[model samples]
Target chain A: MNLLVDAFAWIFDPAHQAGANGIPTRLVQHLGISLLVLLVASAIAIPVGYLIGHTGKGRTLAVSLTGGFRSLPTLGLLIILALWLGVGLEAPLIALIVLAVPPILAGAYSGFEAVDRRTIDAARAVGMTEWQIVSKVEVPLGLPLLIGGLRSGTLQIIATATLADYVGAGGLGHFIFVGQKSNDYPQMLAGSLLVIALALLSEGIFALLQKLVVPRGVVANQSTDVRRPSSRRVAVVGFPTEERK
Target chain B: MNWVIENLPLIGQRTLEHLALSIPPIVLSFVLSVPIGWLANRYRWSRGVLLTVLGLLYAIPSLPLFVVLPIILGTGLRDSVNVIVALTLYGIALMVRTTADALGSVSSDVTQSATAMGFSPWTRFWRVDLPLAGPVLLAGIRVVAVSTVSLVTVGAVLGIKSLGLLFTDGLQRNIVAEVATGMVATIALALVIDFALVLAGRMLMPWTRTVSPKRERRALPVDEAVTA
Candidate 1:
C-alpha cells in the first residue's frame, strides 16, 4: 500500500518529474523512436498487404509466412537484432518493424478478401480497371480492417518498445530497468502505470477512429440482421440464411 | 556446430522447460476463460469494465510486468506466477470478447426456435450456442496458445529457466550456436503448438467442415450476381 502511494508521489513530484534526466523530454524521445518504428513498419506492411490483397494470388502463403513472423518472440528478435546491429535504437526498431508487419499484412489481406464480392464485380462490370477496382473499391471497403490491424500493431509496438531499454535506447523502459536494479518500487510502478495509460489511451483513440472510418453500410447490415423478426423465428428448419449467403 | 553437440543435453532440458512453462498457461487460460466469459456475458455493465481492463492488460509490455511482479510477490516462481496471472488476465479478455461476439453472431431465429422447442436456457446454450460458437472460440484460443508459447520465453528473462534464457545467455556470450538452437527450438515449439491447436479445432468443431459445402453453393450465385 505504501509502495503504491510512494510510487504515485514519485511520479507526480516536480523534482522527479522527468527523472534525473528531463522526464518529458526523454518520454518524447522514446515516443519518437516508437512512432518511427511503427511508421516504417506500416509503410512496408501496408503496401505489401495491399499488393497481396489486390492480386489475390499466393496470399495464403504470404499471409502464413507473415503470421509465422508475428509469432517469433519480440524479446528474442530484439536480442538478435541488437547483436547483429550492435545495439542502439536502430536494432530494436528493425526488430519491431518485423513484429508489426504480420498483423498489418494479415489484416489488410483479410479485410480486402472480405470486401463484398458483389461490390468488386459491380466495379469490374462498369469497366473499372484492376487498379481502379482496388484503389477505389476494395481499398475503401477494406480500410476499417486495415486500420484495426494498424491499431493493434501500433499498440503492440508501443508496449514492446520498453524492451529497447535493455539495449540502451531510452524510454519509459529506462525507469523500469533502473528501478529493477535499485529495487525502487515507486519508480517501477510509475513506469508501468505510464505504459498502461498509454495503452488504454491508444485503444480508445483507435476505437474512435474505427467508428469514424468503418462504412455505415457494413454496420447497418450487421445490426439489422440481428434485429430482424425472422431472426427470432429460427425454425431450426434450416441453417441461418446469412451463413449460407 | 561443435556447440550443438556439446550442448545437446542442455538443449533438450531447455525444450522440456519451455514446454512446461508454455503448456500450463495455455491450458489454464483456456479452462478459466470459458467460465469467465460466461460470467461476463451474464453481467452487462461489469462485462464492459472487465473487457476494458483486459484490453489494457493486453497492452502491457511483458518486461515491465516481470519486474513489477517481484516487487509485489517476492520472487522466483511467485514472480512467474504473476506472469501467468497477467497472461491469463489478457487471455480471458480476448476469449470473452471473442466468445461473446461469436454467440452474438448466432441468428436470433435459432435461439427463438430452440426456445420454442421447449429447450431450457441451459440446454439451448450447451446444445446450440456452445456448438456453434466452438469454431470462433477455438480460433481465439489458437491465437492465445501461439502467443503464450512465445511469451513463455519472456517468463524466462526473470530467472525462470526456459528457452528464453538460452537465447538471452547466448546473445550475451556471443554463442551463435546456442542462439540458433534456442531460436530453432522456440520456432519449432510454436509450430507444433499451432498445428496441434488447428487439429483440435478441426476435431472439436465438425460443423466447421460441413458448413463449407452450403457456403460453396451460395458462392456461385453471389459470384454471378456480382459479375452481372
Candidate 2:
C-alpha cells in the first residue's frame, strides 16, 4: 500500500517531470516505438498470413517457422542488431518487429484456417470468385482472430520494447535502467506499472474493438473466444488450440 | 565457424548457465501449475479470474519484472534466484491456462464413464483425465520451454550471465560472432526442445500420430476435387 502510494508520488512529482528524463516524455517514446513496431508487423504479417490461409498451401510450415521467431531472445536480438546496425532506432525497432510478426502471422493464417471448410465450399457453390470469398467471407469471419493476433503482437511489443533502453533507443526503459543502476526501486516499480498499464489498456481496447468489428452471426458465442483465446497466443508460438466442433 | 570452434569452452559454459537458468523454472512452474490448473478447471467460478490473473502477470514486461522481482523477493539483482523466479512466473502464467485447457479438453463422456465405474475423483483425474490431457499439456509445455529459453537471456541485463551475456558482451565489443553464436545457441535450444516435445507427444499419444478416419474422409474428397 505504502509502496503504491510512493510509486504514484514518484510519477506525479514535479521535480521528476522537468528533465530529459520526464515520465511524459519517456511514455511518448515508449508508445511511439511500440506503435511503430505494431504497424510494421501488422502490415507484413496480416497480408502474408491471409494469402497463406487462403491458398492453404505452406500455411502450416509458415506458421510453425514464424513461431520460431518467438523464442529468439529480444534482448539478445536487440543487442545484436544494435551492434550491427549501430545504436539508433534500427536495432530495437527491427528486433521488436521481428518479435511482433509471429503471433500476428499465426493469428491471421490460423484464423483463415479456423474458418469452416464448409463455408468456403458453400461460397464456391454460390459462384463467388476466389478473391471475393476471401475478402467477403474469409476475412470478415477471420477478423476476430486477426485482431486477436494484432492484439497479441501489440501486447508483446509493448511489453518487450522496454528493452529499447538496453540499446539507448530511449523509451520508458530509461527510467528503469537509470533507476536500477541507482537502486531506485520506487522509480523502477513506477515504470513497470506504466508498462503494465499500457499493455492492459491495449488489450482491453483491442478486445472491445474485436467485439465491435466481428459480426454477431460469425462467432457463435463469447465462449469461442475462451476456447481459442487467440489460438494459444500466450502459450506456444504456433500453438494452435484444437478447434472444438 | 572458426570463432565458434576456438571459443567452444566459453560457449559451452554459457550454454550450461543458460540451461541451468531456464530448466529449473520450467520444471518448477510445471510442478506448481498442475494443481492450480486442476482447481481452475474444476471450479468454473475461478477459471476466468485465474487465467486472467496469470495473463496479466505475463503481460508485465520482463525488464520491469526482472528489476522488480528482487525487491519483491528481497534478493539482489545479481542473484540467479531473480532470473529463476521471473521465468517461473512467466512459465506458470502460460502453463496454467494451457494446463486447465488440457484438462478441460478431456471429453466429459470419458470422465462420466470413469465415474460410472465408481472410480474416485482422484483416480479419474490421474487415470483418465491427466493421461487424456497429456498431449495438449505437452503442447503447452513446448511453448513454455521455448519462451523460457528466450526469456532467460533477458537475465543478461541484470548480470545473471547466461549465453545472453555473449550477446551483451558481443554488442559492447562489436563482436558479431559472439552475438550471433549466442542467438543461434538460444534458438537451437528452443527448437530442439520443441521438436523433442513433438516427438515425445507423438510417442505418448500414438493415436494422434496416425491418420484418423474422419481426417481421411476430408482428405480423399479434397484430393479428388483437386485432381479432377
Residue lDDT tens for model 1, B112-219: 789999999999999887787788888888888778878778765556778888777977797767777778788889889889988888888765775577777676
At residue A181, give the lDDT of candidate 2: 86
Q: Model 2: what is its DockQ?
A: 0.41
Error of 2 at A45 (Å): 1.3
Per-residue accuracy of model 2 over B45-137 as CA lDDT, tens digit each? 788889888887877777778877766788876889988998899899998998888888776767767999999999988889888888878
Query: Which digits, one per residue and each the tens of the lDDT, describe model 1 over residues A1-245?
Result: 57778878988889866544656865786688778977888888888888888778879798678667756877788787788888687888887788888888888888888888888889999999998998888887888889889988887788777777777788877777687678776887888777666767778888898889888866665542222234323345556664422
Provide TM-scores for the models.
Answer: 0.84, 0.87
lDDT (10s digit) by residue, model 2, range A137-165: 99998988899888888988987788888
Q: Which TM-score value belongs to model 2?
A: 0.87
Question: Candidate 2: where are CA atoms >4 Å away?
Answer: A1-6, A221-245, B195-228
* Candidate 2 chain B least-lDDT 10 residues: B216-225
